[model samples]
Target: MKKILMSACFLGQKVRYDGQDSLLEHPLIQQWKEEGHIVPFCPEVAGGLPTPRHPAEITTRHPVMVVNLIGEDVTPQFLQGAELAVEKAKEVGACCALLKSRSPSCGNRETYNGNFDGTLVPGSGVTAAELQRHGIPVFNERELDQLVEFMTMQEADVA
Candidate 1:
């Protein structure tokens, strides 16, 4: 069976920056769980960041660089965690990742602006970028259908 990297919080794991789990309950996710396709991860937490840590956003005008919103310094911890996630994906032979959106380490195509202006812009999170760079397809919660279709096609090809 093929494996898939999934956001820990989405699987009801308490690993979000806010110390709360996203706890998304979806039929597809449940099915995947039964099939043992999920490899849960939280890059921010894996990087040794505490829950309820400082909320961060991409500020370097580039999504690839993660920095402190107020201080503008690189977040080495987050980067480390993202790298860990990529490593985990590779170890598991996961071809795709399902990540939480609007997160500093898991956002796929949109993240929050650091200005607290309630603005969302196109970007990829640290972990998302690492996975993409390593040839893993990343998707947000909204893209579950697409993920299912893609995974199904890959499974068929394998068969």
Candidate 2:
């Protein structure tokens, strides 16, 4: 079975910035759990940010930069977290990452627009982008159907 890297929150861990869990009820995730194919991780927390910490966002479209609501630049920490996540994926030989949606560290294709105004925009989070750069396909919880297709393709390639 292919190993999957996933957000810690999805696994019911209190790893979110707010120190709360975002447990997943999706069937695909449950299936993975039953099969023991999931590896849970949290980039932000792994990078040394505290629980109940300030939320951060990618503040630009180019030359990506992450910043907190208080106007503090957190790019280095985010990048470090992303790199660590990549290391975890490599260590486990993860075929993909199932990340939290709209998170600065885990969003796959859409994150907060950086205004602290609750607007969203198209862009993968630091860890998601880093994982993709390292050849791991990243998906949000909503993209389980698409992940099934990807897994099938991977299986075909292995065969």
Each candidate structure's count of clashing pairs: 0, 0
The TM-score that candidate 1 achieves is 0.92
* Residue pairs in candidate 2 whose N, alpha carbon or C atoms collide under 3 angstroms: none
Please report, in order, the local distance difference test score of every candidate based on alpha carbons: 0.84, 0.90
Candidate 2 lDDT by residue in tens digits, 1-159: 789999999999998878899999888788888999999999998887888888898898578898998899988888889999999999989999999999998999899999999999998999999999988999898888898898889889999
Per residue, candidate 1 scores C-alpha lDDT tens digits across 1-159 of 589999999988887766789987989889989999999999988887777666777775443556664565557777898899989999999989999988878999988876657799887878898899889999889998999898998899899
Positional deviation of residue 142's Cα in model 1 after best superposition, in angstroms = 0.5
Q: Please report, as a residue range, the 10-residue window in candidate 2 with the lowest summed lDDT.
A: 53-62
Model 1 residue runs over 4 Å out of place are: 61-74
lDDT of 2: 0.90
Against the true structure, candidate 2 reaches a TM-score of 0.93
Q: Lowest lDDT 10-mer window, candidate 1?
A: 60-69
Residue 61, candidate 2: alpha-carbon lDDT: 52
